[model samples]
Target: RVSMACCLNMCGAVHCSDIAILGYHRKPPMLDHEYMDKMCEIPLAIAACPTAAIKPAKITLPDGKEVKSVSVNEPRCM
Candidate 1:
């Protein structure tokens, strides 16, 4: 059997096994367009992802406000 932990603080057998189980926090990225454009750097966020699951995107609200945003590819996300 194989066993592991998501973090070193959580487990000690990460390096001692042939098959180590790595855990992922599976959750979609929460986007706040208004705040994102004002406070965050979109490209930096996308590049920071190890899985490359984030991509640049645009959103059009019902009120016709076009907001620049980032999209998270859920299937590729880990």
Candidate 2:
């Protein structure tokens, strides 16, 4: 018997199949600075990253308040 799985979710009969393939997330997550500053907790959000991809970003708002921005490490993303 032959079975296949597309993205490592293993929706197919992988074990029953003679061959198996596992996939993972190649692309990293998207980060919205506006969303983060207003609604998300910066430190907690960074810590939640499994791969530590999210780094601390800082930006200066027009009002002189600190605005956080990027927070993504591409090499560390996956």
Candidate 3:
């Protein structure tokens, strides 16, 4: 999971394979998953972001495999 935050003092993007999603601003539940390879449901995850900070990306992994994932575009307020 990922979170989009806006702060004038901080820059850069952070990605995490596992995360906790809060419900109704309540306690968040932990989510664990395996490798995030191509064909992952990235658009679905990005769609969940209220800030619209994420977008689908074509990235080459260390293993030389290209995959579709999400990347955060910082410095822009969505």
Which candidate number has the best TM-score? 1
Q: Candidate 3: deviation at residue 22, Å?
A: 2.8
Per residue, candidate 1 scores C-alpha lDDT tens digits across 13-75 of 667777887775657656777667778788877766767777998988678999888888888
lDDT of 3 by residue, 11-45 (tens): 21324325433223222222222244433466665
Better of 1 and 2 by lDDT: 1
Q: In candidate 2, what are the lDDT values of residues 12-62, reduced to their tens digit? A: 558677887655666865665656777876786566566667778797666
* Model 3: CA > 4 A from native: 1-34, 37-40, 76-78
Write down the worst ten-residue block by lDDT for model 1. 5-14
Q: Clashing pairs in model 3?
A: none
Alpha-carbon local distance difference test for all models: 0.71, 0.66, 0.48
Misplaced by over 4 Å in model 1 are: 1-24
Ranking by TM-score: 1, 2, 3
How close is every model to the real structure, measured as TM-score? 0.60, 0.49, 0.45
